[model samples]
Target: MVGFYNSLYNLAHTHLNDTYELLTSLQGRLSPAQTTTLMQSTSWDEIIFVSQRSPRKSSPGLDGLPYEILDILIRVPCFHGLILTSQPVRFGSCYRC
Candidate 1:
């Protein structure tokens, strides 16, 4: 059992490292324009639309914030302003809780 666990751990670690390396290589190969497009700041309308479309019972994220709460928060004027003014550093990424 101990050996099985060790082997599983090693396999997971190796897979994670390989995935990271592949992502890094792919990122390095992207053109400046492509990277810019990927990191483009999203619009409030787009966010609101996505939030509204999301399944109500979907699992909560790491922060344990509910999807319903996010849906409500996204419509707030201050939140819209913050998202509009912020710079995007990564693809499909949002502010951490």
Candidate 2:
């Protein structure tokens, strides 16, 4: 059991490092127009539209929050504010991030 976990961790770590290197090599290759489009802030309508288009109950995330739940949660003012500020909620911390 322990060996399985260790091997899994090692495989994930190696893959992530390789993926990071590949992405790093592609840096500064974007056109000026592409960079401008990527840098633009996403609008609320865009976010809501994406959420609506996503699968509702078929694939829940690790946190078990489905797109439907997420869609509803984001509609609330407080959660909406958190999303806008980009402050993710830590498991038990008030504001670690």
- Alpha carbon lDDT at 88, candidate 1: 35
lDDT, candidates in the order shown: 0.68, 0.72
Query: 1-97 in candidate 2: lDDT tens per residue?
Result: 9998898878556777788899888967889999999999878888788888898675434556678777877777667766655555667865322
All candidates' TM-scores? 0.45, 0.55
Worst window of 10 by summed lDDT in candidate 1: 82-91
Candidate 1: which stretches are off by over 4 Å?
Answer: 1-28, 59-61, 82-97
What number of clashing residue pairs does each candidate have, in the order they appear? 0, 0
Pick the lDDT winner.
Answer: 2
- lDDT for 29 in candidate 1 is 80
